[model samples]
Target: MRGDTSNYRDLFLGDVPMMDARAPIEFRKGAFPHTVNLPLMTDSERQKVGTCYTQQGEAAAIALGHRLVSGQVKAERLAAWADFARAHPDGYLYCFRGGLRSQIVQTWLREEAGIAYPRVIGGYKALRGFLLDTLDRALAECGFVVLGGMTGTGKTDVLAQLAHGLDLEGHAHHRGSSFGKRVTGQPAQIDFENGLAVDILKKRHAGHAHFVVEDEGQAIGACSVPVGLHQGMQRYPLVWLEDSFENRVRRILRDYVVNLGAEFVAEHGHEQGQLLFAQRLRQSLDKIQKRLGGLRHQQLAAIMDAALAEQARGGGVEGHRAWIEALLTSYYDPMYRHQRESKAGRIVFSGDEAAVLEYLRRASTMARRPDPGTSA
Candidate 1:
């Protein structure tokens, strides 16, 4: 029976002969489609069991679990299982593994209600194996197009605007920066990968010629890009966006305001935010610091301070544009130039937002063209 249990793909793709069972949190983190959580144990109960395992070993923990699940509580759990089985008549059940806990639940469900819930042979472990296998397959077979640029080039924004491609940064809920945390929350590492896997699967299913993604380091915020996927990305041709320093700064300011809102300026206080932004500016100016030393940092800081104050005082378009351009030319441009030169296989596309969007659209269309002599 265990040998005949369905794989995760079969279950998630709705090919399963039965409904699937897992815990609610686990299901939310990642789960097969059409799955249900009939938690044999609550979150606190699971935590206590884990603590017992660490302090008292598996045998003692198992005994404690049995002891804790007794009387009315046990009866209620059995009743819930009966209800679930009725609702999902052809459902199968699984715990972390096709182990004793699952056996206990299966036996109770059968004895009390005369309903048999098939158990996944290796349970969650088998599902994990399936996910890993699928990811590896995707990494090996997919054609990737890497979008590369320095900070504040709006690489993510451009990627989003492009049609028919995965947005890796969006999936990770990060801007891929020193200060990239979302205003809401970040996804757990497992959840991030699960979302990424969904995108990869969708692209593959569509027979996409290639999927576009931002050029990212090994990790994005709290989530680590899988090694296989990272390697796959590195092999693809790179598309580098070139923008004027003035334009880049304007873009960054606009992005920050849009994503973080006026409250960001208000919360940090215009003066403090100005100071921090200047400090970042100085760091970006480190190459010239040796010749100019402390004086350079101070000069840039002062300029940044004044510019930020103007913005605070409602320095409309001109003031904002001037400040952003100064920082970009005096800092971002040089840094990006050095880094961009070091990268290989780059196809440079120079333009403002609309022009860049047009370039990507053209590239995507060309990639999708059918091979000559291929059957209709």
Candidate 2:
């Protein structure tokens, strides 16, 4: 934190824990991958300091912060920092900008607990900037291939098997569909972007070419893709995988109903988990009700209820296919068809899953080979 502000490797290159000295709300909004929030000031105290800074000045804010966080309160926070430092001796502390808050934490740890550690030099902002720049570079320099398909075509599956694949949906903890929300909450925007950059950099450094990505909207759940990367996807060579409607129905059932339902049960317990899964399905259908139309919506809802009833009785989710049929035939397929019409010109390859995989494998090999004329 003192000498260099550019070495971001210490935080991201390995499994080093970082002590975030920002307030709780700030940390919840967006933070680094491994950062543990251990603030110098509580949210209320920070708010008070912010008010003082606005009303009086920096000097007044500093005085108010010092006054508010003293005696037992100060000792408790310092003790927390000391405990974290003792646990992770190689760890560093960071604030929003490596400014006063971080310096105070660093100074306290050194003087009180005798743990002198460097904080992130430019802090969260700098590290984030580094990742953003990394994404920018990858978009500019790396060849990109966009994998696209109808909703249940398992484009994600095809992407996962390729050496050049970049699983954006997996990174975002989303399937890029209406019912794609995971059991756990999605990562913050910063964490999402950071993970994307790290993945891209790893693949790039390994001399992988044509970063293969799945079709996605600009936003995946709560997070938005970077402009450069999104645009790159739009313009990249497109490979669309096609599958039978029955095959897609089976895949959707396996993914959304069976697998996800089991995961919810594993995480949330039986009764509550069953209710949650049923609720999520109903909600997803409800979300696009207008698109699904009144009669179809009502029909789908009835089928979903029946499916839930069957599932609640400790039976297989084969009944979900009726609703899935109504969904794909009525909702998802139509929407995908419209989008496909628009991007039809961009598609360079279109086939079943097996053909797509073979194409990607061959393409990856071709892209990675050096030209004989240029080779040393």
Candidate 3:
């Protein structure tokens, strides 16, 4: 018999042992949860086969693949499969598709080792389908609370402090911004959503507390947010953060400079990026230039220039606080005022970071409280 194929859906839904038969590079790009690599072909082997397929056609590549897998190599692979099967007796395995690679491994496990582990019907493709479907369903069912504020209001930092659930924090590894990409590579979009799905499922299973997340505008670096989730965030209830311009700039410098490191900025042509950032900053400042005037903008420019100089000199935190304070007061504050006036929402509560955390805590508490009308 075919063992029990009926449990495959359940296996996929929950965590189940799986294997990626692709090269390490392909696997690193994205992979299913609980997946181990048991590649039939090594990285160079796959590349060679691919080159043959392109140059010599399918027949030649297939013949070469067969030749490569025969003899001692095949015996060692069978031994490894036997070990893996013994370790994860109930596990399923897959390749890019339900193809020859999976068949060879499945046969070794079942026929030789007498261990039955069904292959995924469509392999990684099926897992991709499931991930997309789950994310779409989540978008429709879940409530979202968008955390919005000007740069350096510590929106991401505050999200961490709050007890509420977050989807993007762990996957992106940094707050979403032009500089969001860290020294480490980000998770692939599929892996990001995989992590996101876990967060969403946990929140839903706990009950319908609104999921708190930062107001990211679609794509974050190389990874794109799922369209459904992105759409939901736009219409969701929003909590706008308010902070002193001085304080906000201070926070931005502290967070970005200290955490990101001065060398990072220098290595990436920090001065040039800062100059461009200043131009954008100047445009935002242009709206209020009538009130603050060109001289104020120039003063702000001078402060930013000085801060960059201090950073280049590897100066500590001394001059940074005062410079950031001036930029926020003279620049970032007025822009926020215009934004606040235009926003539409029942301002549930507002204050600095502490107040935001307090509100979220209260909201979470209310969500968990038993309703008087519904009996347990």
Candidate 4:
């Protein structure tokens, strides 16, 4: 049997498999990327045990937990765990605090199944704390550049080309706007932060001490940027990306209308997918109604609805350009212009896509070059 581990760095770096022995509710609330939830007790059982502990103390809780999970129930759980152990001999098991639940699983595996699997030394809490610390350290020590542009300038496309780019919106499964919601839901807040931290950790390990991240607000849909990262972004050097008004309209049309509709259809099939996609577009416009004001909101929504209808009838996507251009000119452009003006002092480079990409790549290359004048 392998010993329990507290080597959080190694675990993340190696992408080790993990069995979460916490309740399903706890796992749903927050969990690592590759970890699977194989609960030691169901949510109901956990609730009863928690109540027993609160009312009668540890011993009563312990007794009640055992009684609740005996006979066939116990055997079934044991089989599941044994199967996991046999399948992932390199993985570790964990509970919330690496306490009672994990210890029980470890013990049962040893005694009943003749297998001794290791548990994470401090379990979920410790690993989560480690990720938080990792993010904080990265913020404190690393160099960052924030990419800023008007809507539909393709900031994500630029980031995709850079080795040191951090895709914050991608991590959050959002596009960082009122209309940024995807066909699928965003990750849990904890999951978003964990994924971001892991990405930063992996990049830092690969000798990237500098990164480029898109300029975004504190929250992206339901996911919030960690406090330190958000604060650092406020001060980072700004690189402005630009494109023609016509090109911007086409980009937004492809991303939000055409591509988004296709995603929905692919996930839900043709009929229901088209219905939901149309609904989502209308809902997105409605969300900004207060900000856009009544008459203007009505005007934009009307254009959008008409566009969606035309596309639905197989009349082609050219109709979406009218609404997208109007939205960009009336709504998004004004707000972004103000933001750019406010951050004028921090704007180190301003260019179209290819120029911005070249500048960033050159900057990253220069930053990583060793100083031959200094001793190793």
- Tell me the tens digit of each residue's lDDT in model 1 across 241-301: 6666555676777765333434344557766654554444335345345644577556655
lDDT of 4 by residue, 1-376 (tens): 5799998887887899999999999998999978999999999999999999999999999999999999999999999999999999999999999989999999999999999999999999999998888888778777899999989999999999998999999999999998999999999999999998888787777777788999999999999998888998999999999999988888898899889989999999999999999999999999999999999999998998898889889848898888888888899999999999999999999999999999999988776633211111
Q: State which candidate, 2 or 3, has the greater TM-score.
A: 2
* Best-matching candidate per lDDT: 4
Show model 2 residue runs off by greater than 4 Å: 1-5, 368-376
Per-residue accuracy of model 2 over 104-187 as CA lDDT, tens digit each? 998998898887877888887887787777777767666888898998999888888887898988889987888898778888
- lDDT score for residue 46 of model 3: 85
lDDT ranking, best first: 4, 2, 3, 1
Task: For model 3, name the residue pairs that clash.
Answer: none
Candidate 1 overall lDDT versus native: 0.65
Estimate the lDDT of model 4.
Answer: 0.91
The local lDDT score (0 to 100) that residue 77 gets in candidate 2 is 95
lDDT to native, each model = 0.65, 0.84, 0.67, 0.91
TM-score of 2: 0.91
Q: Which ten residues in a row have the lowest lDDT in candidate 3?
A: 367-376
* Candidate 4 to truth, TM: 0.95
Q: Go through the candidates in order and give the clash count of each.
A: 0, 0, 0, 0
By TM-score, how accurate is candidate 3? Answer: 0.70
Best by TM-score: 4
